[model samples]
Target: MAPSLREGVSQARSFEFLRLGRQAPWLVLGLGLLLGPGAFPHRARAAPASGADPAALLEQGREAYEMLECPKAVASFRKVLAHPKATPAQRVEAYVGQAWCQVVEGNEALARETLQKALEIRPDYPVSPDLSPKLAAVLEAAQRDFRARAKVEIDLDVTARGAPPELGMRVRDPAGQVNEVLVRYRTDGEWREVAAHSEGASLWTARLEGAAAGTLPLYVETKNRYGFVSGREGTAESPVAVRVEPAAVSAALAPPAATGAASGTALTPLAWTAAGLAVATVGAGTFFGLKAKEEEARFNGDPSQFGSHDEALAVGRSAQRNATTATVLFVSAGVLAATSGLLFVVDGSHGPAGDAVEPGFAAAAMPLHGGGLFALAGRF
Candidate 1:
């Protein structure tokens, strides 16, 4: 394979590795949960404190919990649990309150188990109790709701014509489940499903339709086999926004209508002019150089004839002058041709109407005209 192809593949692999490294923390967290919490370090229980006011701490914890202050409530509850004078009922309530605070802060599983421990401690704990009923409701809601996340990875293959003349997408869920993704493209104030989900590895391919292309917001939603729709997670990976830009759109869309058209027309003529100048320069130089060599050969062959010698000397001098003139013209033409060619390339790559046109065609054209005048003088 070519060096460029090798470099591209290496870059792609490096990017993939970096992305996976970033997601390593989430993977480890999931694996730890799957392996069971007992496999991890157990949270240390707060030791019993001597002569602490249990009622006051419970009230403080309740206030913190109501205010949605999870850390503060957890700290106050721990203090209440640690009090030696606290009854079994009060201790259970403290655990239950801590669990409720955890649920409010979005730690669902820990909250459920903490509530379970409270129930186990006091089986007669009233399910209809004000705080207990509210905690139960929160847990039930969490369980009933289907939480899901998704991410899209885009790989742009740059070609000679343009970068990613076509577009595609791949979507993956947290459970390592791949789904055939469809994208509804937004174009000219309207939305259409440009690409249908084909049988592939969660990869959907679509061709770019026009020269004016941008990032189209594609709404992607998927249903599982059980018909449960994935709820939107506000995280970066979920409902990934893919940005697609067609190559050289700005160049193609250059305006000031008349100027743009003139510049575009001028570009082709400039290219051909440069090419013609270069070929002419090279041919002129070569022809004059060969004639000078022939004149030198005749002078060397008959040096004995004084009259012929003077004539040959004049012929040699004239040939030398012609060669010198050709060399100067060749060099001048070459520089102008190269400059024009460079301008044409730059104008073609970017838009032709701005700073690009001013320096290249405008500024250099004057010097080029002067050079042509000098070449005409040399010809005379």
Candidate 2:
């Protein structure tokens, strides 16, 4: 018949002892020579401090287990578990190590209990197949029991419904430990937070209004009374998305606008009058200038034909008066044209219709029959 698990472990230890015992004679003589007869039985050293490195403690515990020191291994593992700054992974590993020691000591019940605590920290903790058959069987039993335990978690159900299109979220906190629930949502580019109100038994609701049509990313978090988050459905880094549809309207809406075309503005009457006056003065100035030239030409052509010196003087004075009249008319035309151009420019702001003409004047003198004729022109 095959040996039991404990019997097999005991037999293996016996074989290791026999192998070491072969060199014990020389080892004992050497130790006696180094420390007199008083060192026949050595005293055990003090345990490591609780504040020691958890990883170091865990390694020490594993080495003790390999040397068949179950009690010392258990103590080292407990120190790792008791460390204040021990990580979850480290604590879980320590618990597993203690459970292995308990299994080797023939305490299967205590080993199973220890394994359950490790599973509480990490339910997916693997049961290594390389473990001894007795320890593997104990680990499998603990995993089965852990799965059969009751579940306590928060649940969130989201729906986009209702008139005017409000987003509704239904939350359930079965553990009854959640003090408050909130939803963080984003419509365009900014994220917003809203508190949820209790609606019914194990049911809470949050309504979000005025969301545009698109994919909205959101997350739900349940907090304790102290404002620390206890449970969460989604996170800010990885948010859940829901579709928002556009609202529909009836076909029979309001009528078209009453005024469609933009009102236009024309040049004022005052501006038109100034322009007309400018043109009339230019025509009058040209006529007077031609008359001045004709008078001078006739007077110079025949001095005796004038019939008398007085007539000739009268003709010369008449030519001088015509020339002065032409000069005055041309000056008046330039002033009138400038006024017209200024008015046009001011009125141009009312509309964009005609080209802008700059107001300017040019004068030239030509010698005709030993007499000068002045000509002036203006643009408006």
Q: Estimate every model's Cα lDDT from 0 to 1.
A: 0.54, 0.67
1-380 per-residue lDDT for model 1 (tens digits):
55698899999999999999999868765643432233111335444433458967776776565445669978988998888888766787798777776765668788766765554344324444323444556544433331212222333222111244344443445543233334444557665544434436655555545424545444544333323333221222333334554466423422223343444545667777877887887888788777778776766676765476568779778778877877887797788788777866755543444434332211111111113211111100
Q: What TM-score should be assigned to candidate 2?
A: 0.35
Worst 10 residues of 2 by lDDT: 249-258
Q: List the residue pairs that clash in candidate 1.
A: none
Best by lDDT: 2
Separate clash counts for every candidate: 0, 0
In candidate 2, what are the lDDT values of residues 1-380, reduced to their tens digit?
Answer: 99999999999999999988997767755633432222111224436434479877876776576565779988989999999978887888799888877766778899889998877666556656455556668888998786566222545443343333455444544434467888888866788888887877766767666566667788888775545464576778999776554553211111222233331235556677877887898888888888889889988886768888898888888888988998898898888778877776676444234434344445433222234545554432
Q: Give the TM-score of candidate 1.
A: 0.24
TM-score of each: 0.24, 0.35
| lDDT value, candidate 2, whole model | 0.67
Give stretches of model 1 more than 4 Å off.
Answer: 1-267, 304-307, 352-380
Error of 2 at 161 (Å): 5.3
